[model samples]
Target: MGVGRILLNILVVLAAIAGGFYQLKLKPILVKFGQGRVIDPRGNTDCTTVPELKACEKLVLHQPSGVVYLACSTQESRPHWLPNAQRFNATGASRTDYVASYNPQSGKVTKLKTVNFNSPRGLSLHGMDVVASSSNPSELWVYLVNHREPLSGDPKVVGADSSVEVFKTTLGGSTMEYVRTVEDPLLLTPNDLTGTPDGKAFWVTNDYGVKTGLIRDLDLLGRATTSVVYCHETEGCKYAIQNMHGNNGIAQAPNGTFYVVNAIGGQLTVLEKQADNTLIITDVIESDRSMDNASIDSEGDVWVAGFPKALVLVYEHFANPTKVVSPSTAFRFSINTGPNSFYGQKFKVDRVCDRSSYTLSVACHRIT
Candidate 1:
């Protein structure tokens, strides 16, 4: 070998010897690498099988806390999967409409609180809190469940319908106030929902109980508007929707395309806004059976977390899926949802109408 080559080989050998010594006497250096890991496609997580979850419904990841809070339906209460579980006897909920929170970073739970829900169903995680929809009290009603842990079990009031109560979150604590309810144009006997990541609007859908079709629209300021599509109805444009899972769980793609799940429709549908800015379902993701609520990661790998037989299913692309099954799959759920936090920025800013809320005028001195 040439002198340089000999020197390089000697250096490598020396590094190995030194590394060994350092590992024994000093801090050891560790390196992490990624690989292709195989997972089972058919695993079940349910009260009957996994015995951890009583029933899994809406699931979501709260980025700030690095946790996954799932709304579950149980025969009696939130199951043994969590230690400190909370239960709300939603006077209208079937004893299964309680909320549960878990930390994905540590794979442990921090808090589990229940909202007194009547007909409580769909659940989603927002910022650091939880939003649960229930008609326990009224028709135009939806309740926002906060992250607060109460002192003890709060008995669910019987025959109570407090859906008109609205909620907002602050750094200090959770606040519940009343907001005017808009008429239910969609006739939402709601199934699933997802608010736009931009925090501008939200989408809710009912699983087509009537031929009127599954509900779809934007919730802006408590005002619900059925998407106006036909150009003749608007300015002479015909609108069509495709790529829908038929309203299983409304999930936003990492790049903003929306995917629909049927949960039992046995299909994962995808929807996109047209170039003309009208909405349409364009594609459907399929498997041996219907898929439920799904979450997409930065790599565009879609994770369908759900049940009958519970599974954490993965796909290579939204349109095409290469099945990935996690070993922990084995739960039966009615509905499921989750998110993969890659990296980005999340913030809430104060808005001021005027340019100079506080003026800063600098005094300058002339220097020669």
Candidate 2:
């Protein structure tokens, strides 16, 4: 072995070590970090008028007072590196996700307390009581499929199973307090929920089963194997309707009729309560856009949040988190009950809000 041969051997050894480190360690870490990264698109558009409206996931209105409460998840804010890493930050902390209250008369929004749970997606309120579904992954064991601990802290402190949070608002609509959290095995992907008039029992929509990756995507594109569960204080949660296609929002009318939106099917199903407390499908109304949550106004009309463009807004949000703008519309429909049949009348569809944001729930001010 001469000097040149020895040098060549040394070079080969060093190159082999570098290749192993890159292939085995560095690549996996990069892929894991990339999963949590968000790429926001850059652009600007001024459509604040009628054609374009602000995006909101859930909206609840105080009937007599006309105070509108909105749950704006700001899902785009979730994927950024620093915020994703820290569940709680001491310095320059990120804005907490909150339920915002909009005064229809004054046009002023008062943001309530930041929700304790992550990913506050859907919201429903009756009188001063409110219920919402939190779909945070660490909050739910289901999200562990692609779980990556926020880069900086002990993963244990930041992650837990998901649940539904209940709250009560003051009559003045100035404040709210956390009442209790509902964790049930039946609540596998709880999306939107509606409370009873008395605020005792509630109904929730599970968007999908315990699934992820391509299977979940395919299930959504096809008919979703989701269901709606009725949750009670003593009896716990039970299945109300099964095998729904993208079950989303749910609302109950004053007459005890239930209205549910099948997001993928683009239709609203009207359910009537039987003597045994089970619900019977009374009617189904076709919709032009993907329907989300439904709220019954004082006049027995149902107000729904409509996603006109399907999942284009969702793709845009993932591609360009910041610059993505999606259109949102609200529709008002009337339900006429006959002795033998049920009829639905489309009163009007209003382009209330727009932008890159999505609206989840809708409610009208009713003095109940």
Candidate 2 TM-score to native: 0.63
Q: Give me the candidate number with maximum lDDT.
A: 2
lDDT of 2 by residue, 108-163 (tens): 76766633434332232111224332332111110001112233543334331335
Candidate closest to the true structure, highest TM-score: 2
Off by over 4 Å in 2: 1-55, 78-95, 114-160, 318-321, 336-368
For residues 262-290, write the lDDT of model 1, one tens digit per residue.
54444456577556544676655444333
- Candidate 1 lDDT: 0.34
lDDT of each: 0.34, 0.54
> What's each prediction's TM-score?
0.42, 0.63
Tell me, what's the RMSD of every candidate? Answer: 22.5, 13.8
